[model samples]
Target: MRRVIMLRALVWSVLLFVVSFGCAQERDPIVRIQANALSKAFFVGDLKDPTDDPEFYLRATVVDVASGAGSDGLFTNSDAQPTVRVRFEITEDMLLARLTYERID
Candidate 1:
């Protein structure tokens, strides 16, 4: 009888652990490739845990300098320098805006 009780408790403990771990996980990648094509900073506001997806817009900050006036072709064709890295989180209502940095020569 004691052995049976111990085995049942162990099984319950393992199941509980797995369920809690999955619930604590976060969401998917917030930014899409189409959004990254824009030559400005994209701000996603108020990202919480990993189980949320927010809908937001983008605002252009700095355009390409040498391409042309009002021309966003200033970035290079190669996947080398002059790129932006966006750090963000997913939330229920708004996206969590982390930080965006431009790497250009």
Candidate 2:
């Protein structure tokens, strides 16, 4: 009886482990950004579709961009939105952070 229960418990543990692992893997997104879209948004602040208010023209993940350096997404406006075009990169301290629309695959 002891052996049977122990064996059953081991099997159940393995099953549970596998199930949990599979779930974790699926929870993360696996996606590729369009290069044209990425460059346009990151460099030119041009989103092909000039969306509605807040203007979510870019489809991307909130991520780091390096311009001979590294950068993180930042917010702007009274609404506190992440990424806004700020004067054509005119100011030394200003940066454009466009809202990212993530595409899940």
Candidate 3:
């Protein structure tokens, strides 16, 4: 009886572990700021659509961009190629953080 219970407990624990691991949340994709959006926003005092070259624009305005989970599906994916979403934030010190850059693929 003891052996049977121990085996059952082990199997249950393994099953639970597998299920939890499988359901684990994946880390968000890395966001590479070709150009800093926050700096541009602060300097320009408005958001400029750098549809022409995001990497260049972002790199220029990359004061400090923060990272957070957000879906890119809300807006059109025409600006950032392969970037389905972007993780970013603007700090009080007027910094733009481009922490994660995700590709649609």
| Candidate maximizing TM-score | 3
The parts of candidate 3 lying over 4 Å away from their true place are: 27-92, 95-105
Considering every candidate listed, which one attains the maximal lDDT? Answer: 1
Q: Estimate each model's TM-score.
A: 0.26, 0.30, 0.30
Per-residue CA lDDT of candidate 3, range 3-104, in tens?
A: 999999999999999999999998999987676444554332335443332332333222333477354652344334432323334445654445245435
Candidate numbers, best TM-score first, in rank order: 3, 2, 1
> How much lDDT does each candidate structure score?
0.53, 0.50, 0.52
Query: Which ten-residue region of model 2 has the weakest summed lDDT?
Result: 82-91
Q: After superposition, how far is residue 20 of candidate 3 from its true place, in Å?
A: 0.4
- Model 3 scores a C-alpha lDDT of 0.52
Global CA lDDT computed for model 1: 0.53
Off by over 4 Å in 1: 27-105
Residue 51 accuracy (lDDT) in model 3: 32
Clashing residue pairs, backbone N/CA/C < 3 A, model 2: 83-97
In model 1, how large is the Cα lDDT of residue 55? 35
- How well is each residue in 2-64 modelled by candidate 2, as lDDT tens digits? 999999999999999999988884456866766554333444454443432233333334455
Error (Å) of candidate 1 at residue 29 is 12
lDDT (10s digit) by residue, model 1, range 1-105: 999999999999999999999899687878755843633223333233333433344344544354545534543343233334445554456545543545455
Return the candidate ranking by lDDT, descending.
Answer: 1, 3, 2
